[model samples]
Target chain A: MIAKELFKGTIKTIVLKLLSDQGKMYGYEICQKVKELSDGELMLTEGALYPMLHKMESEGLLKIEKVNIGKRVRKYYKLTRTGKKEFGLKIEEFNNFIQTMKLILNPSINQSI
Target chain B: MGLSDEQVDYIENLLKENGLSYPPLLEDLLDHVCCAVESKMDDGTAFQVAIKEVLNAFGKDGIEKLQVQTLHLLNQKKQLMKRLSLLTLSVLLFTVTYIFAFPIDPPNSSPLKGNAKITAEFGMTFNKLKAQNQFHEGIDFKVPLGTPVYATGNGVVTEIQSKSTGYGHMIVIKHDDHFESLYAHLSEILIQEGEEIKAGQLIAKVGNSGASLSPHLHYEVKKQGKKINPRDYLTP
Candidate 1:
């Protein structure tokens, strides 16, 4: 399992990517999907997930669709135009960061000097 | 496993009581808690046990802390707007009070329009008709009948009295909380009570209407309701 501190910075990128793939998802669906995709190695708490989702909404990165199911209302979030553009940039940056981290962690002897 | 309406209501009320009353945040938290409880119930846990487990998962004051954190971020701009509005209102109130209560210019001009002669001064003097010493409260200006009487300062006309006795046909103008001026022995009043008066504005005509031997204007100045000498404020 990843520590919460490490997971914090990646939440927006992950959410942007998730919404891009799934189109739209509510709070619980996002949490359940992350846990399922990570094979129980990642957990999204209500405290962490909702604030990030709301912050992104306020920043115009996501739009909400509210639906009534029986007596309860469910809020689903989808990426905005800006959010879609951000997703592509974030994915490339994250990929480059992962490659850089791998090089440092598994350094060749010639490069280590 | 889905929650019943009553169960959903219970979760909502719980979140509201714990101080998560913001509607959007409330709705999101409600849906999440219901899903958590329903998932737990699907695993064979009883309804009561499922609800407890879901709440405990949020940790202590976790629901409340979420709202506080959200509002802290959202209210940053709103708080500034509120403070600016309060400051604007205070400055407006101060400006209004300063203009009305303390005029930029003090009462300086004499209440007479032409050559003025002092027949009586403020303080004790002998009244030959009554043949006794009388404490005169105002300075008496000996002006002919139909002479114009003006307001000494910018103020509101607080009172107008018409009588055939002492200080007859008087007009009182309150300049501020600290100062008020009075004009008496007038034949005709040109302004109404509560009317705004300006300095040197002709407000009345001098007459011998009260208990007097000749036509004169009786003027008095009071500081905080106590009679003070009018000569201090009236320019010669």
Candidate 2:
């Protein structure tokens, strides 16, 4: 299964969690970490990632800090208080949804799918 | 082989010439592209060839496509903001129009519009009891002493006076269209100068207080400081 198709509409929640756990991360670092952690199965595109980052930054859920990195400026994203709270709720909601889907898809003892 | 400042500038100039101008997005994309190209060159890839590989991996329109997507998102946000401010602007316009529209009363609602009664006629030749032959420029209303007299139209009270002689306890209201209405021989004046008076509002009480007058109201309508017969503009 292609990860991009499976990962639609969940970019903000994912980014929020990453920023919450990792503190501050620039765009390139985020792509490398996700690729490494997913074992190259989930690849983030610039088209998807940058737009989400800009939108969430506009929404006040994330804050941006620009720093001089070598020859150019690099922008880092970190979760705000609202972003951390949102990430926590989204994780709990996703866990409940997964449990409910599992109960329906793999019911036992004559509870047919 | 990390790309130098000049190489990064060259890449940025190339992308800018390709129509990517939003600053924050441009900076972020440029740094990422530069990092990718430099890392590939570290593995002995030729500089130009690595740059080509990174740009190709950026997809068909490359930086232009990403710029377009970011602009589209910001445009959606701008439209939402315009909608919110539009609601606020509409509410403000309604309130201003309402406060402005408050002062003007309806035209046919005047007291003299359809129900005027004249006790003494205007422009009457009164034989002089003194020297110059007097022409009565106003009409008289034969109401009882101290009866409330209504304003003929809407206006501001421009003048008021109480005297034992001519035009006693009088009120003069300045109306629109160069018109002024005077209510004289009043037993009591009920309005102040600079106070607004509505059509048919009680401004005085009728009484005999002026030169050779019975218990009545001496009413006058003037245009440009000249007294005109009130019957010319009023209906019975």
Candidate 3:
């Protein structure tokens, strides 16, 4: 099980990859998707996710849209062109890093691979 | 089982009363709390109880802690930008000062003060028993064992010899007029070969090292490798 502290660093990469794959997603939907993908092992609270999203939008990596859902407005995030390019590079780098971590952490599993 | 508009406004006002005034985080927290309470009601929990549990998840500081953390991150970004700009400004100021300070080289003064004897004069036959018949290149000044020798002009040090048979420890400086001067038989050389020196700059100390009868300085000025008399160039 991955800890929330460990997920903190890769949250940007997670959002970038999610937006690239799903086109656009609202804030609640993104948190639910992360939970579902991790088999409910990882949880992203509202406090952490919103600040990261706002920071990304400020950096021009993501664009936001508002949709009227009943009486409230839901904010949806979509990747910009720069965000797409960044996602491609970040995933490749992250995958290589994960493989190196795998070798160090699970040497017996590394023998078979 | 979505929350009513009245329920959303009640939570927002409660948050505002408890010091959650940062707007963006406040709005997002309100949405989060409303959704969580609605979901709990759908699962058979009472509305007020679910709201209490959901708000409790944000801890005793409620939305205030998250707001502080987010603002801190933005402050760090602002501080990093300020430091970078300050660094660039300092570098610019340094370059301006350096350009303005460049033309003040080669101080104007005589090399030696009026206290030493002219041991050997330039351009006539000067013999010390073994050095037969040769025109002396420059005036020899007989100073004490460790008398300070100075640069006679503003120039760069062209050569230095730590131990040569002819002149024990020596330094040669090239001046602005394509003229090079030599200070030889020095007991100690205080400047490096490539260092810029001004007139009256202390360069070495006098010693007896080369073909000489007593402790003295061997000074010579040359142009295009030919020796010139230092007497025509310097006053006493």
Candidate 4:
């Protein structure tokens, strides 16, 4: 389980990175993507995800479009130009973080046995 | 196997009182919680117990945190408006003070020599009229009755009279640079005798005075034995 503070800061980066790759995604779709990528280890509550998405849209980092899907209107979010640039920087930072964590978690694996 | 109409109504009213509009995001979260509670009730749990479990999952602090963020955003907007209003007010105050405190400069600095023309016109004109025979000294200001009269130059107050025989309420400021200013026919005297005064320090309000016709201030600038026209040194 991810610590709340860590999850709070990275949630935006994670969403932006996913949208960068996936073109556009709705609320539920984005939640599903996070779960799948983390191999069911991460679960984002709707309570947390929607507010972050709304805040990002207000901040001009994301843009939203609404589409009618049968009985309901599904709101989809896509990265804005600024968001695309931010996504690149965040991905690089996340990759560096993952590499650092791997080194710390299993120092023996990279060293002579 | 669902929330009864009465329960849903109660929940909706509670959310409304909390100031949340039924936006899609909020509605979806509420609907999911309601469904989860209803499912538990259908499986033999009591209504109250199921509702409690649903609320626990929602977390008490989480809802409050969201509400606080909305209120904080509103408070920040109000603070910005207040700051803007204060800034505008300060600017207006500074402009008014600057206009009154500084003497109006003439279009061109032309020189005047020996007892030039001066008019003791409006508020202090009565005092000028009273002194017309007895050396008819000083120029009068044609300003509003209550306009704050300021010192003509830096000086020390020689006399400040609340009520005297000739000048009614008045002030006499003696300047270091060999000049004396006499302000008479005042509605109120603001300074004290022998107190140091600066140019543009408020000395009195304009008023009718002893042997006068109407409200006005009697202003005099004297250097040695000469009664030069006060207007020569003043800007209108």
Q: For every model in order, what is the number of clashing pairs? A: 0, 0, 0, 7
C-alpha lDDT of candidate 4 relative to the true structure: 0.67
lDDT of 3 by residue, A1-113 (tens): 68768889899999998899899997778888999988988787767887788777766789978766565666778999988988999999999999999899999998896
TM-score of chain B of 4: 0.43
Ranking by TM-score: 2, 3, 1, 4
Docking class of 1: acceptable
Q: Clashes in model 4: which pairs? A: B120-B140, B122-B142, B123-B215, B123-B216, B123-B217, B124-B216, B124-B217
Per-residue lDDT over B1-236 for candidate 3, one digit per residue giving the tens place of the 0 to 100 score:
77888887787787787678877666666666777788889999998899889878877884777787777777777788799999999999999987676543322245566667878888876477455877888778888888888898889998999774677788898875447788888888899878998888899988877665577888888866788777767665
Candidate 1 per-residue lDDT, tens place, B71-104, comes to 7766765687789999999999999988877654
Query: What are the runs in model 4 whose C-alpha is more than 4 Å off?
Result: A68-73, A101-113, B1-19, B22-55, B70-236
Instruction: Estimate TM-scores for all models.
Output: 0.53, 0.58, 0.55, 0.41
Report lDDT (Cα) of residue B94, candidate 3: 94
CA lDDT of every candidate: 0.89, 0.79, 0.79, 0.67
Which candidate leads the pack in TM-score?
Answer: 2
TM-score of B chain for each model?
Answer: 0.56, 0.50, 0.52, 0.43
Minimum summed lDDT over a 10-residue window in model 3 chain A is located at: A66-75
Residue lDDT tens for model 1, A26-104 = 9999999999999998998888888888888877789999999778999999999999998999999999998888888
DockQ of each: 0.42, 0.39, 0.31, 0.06
Q: In terms of DockQ, which candidate is strongest?
A: 1
TM-score of 4: 0.41
Ordered by lDDT, highest first, the candidates read 1, 3, 2, 4
Write down the worst ten-residue block by lDDT for model 4 chain B.
B105-114
TM-score of 3: 0.55
Please give the distance, in angstroms, between residue B100's alpha carbon in candidate 2 and its true position after superposition.
6.6
Model 2: residues with Cα > 4 Å off, grouped in runs: A107-113, B95-236
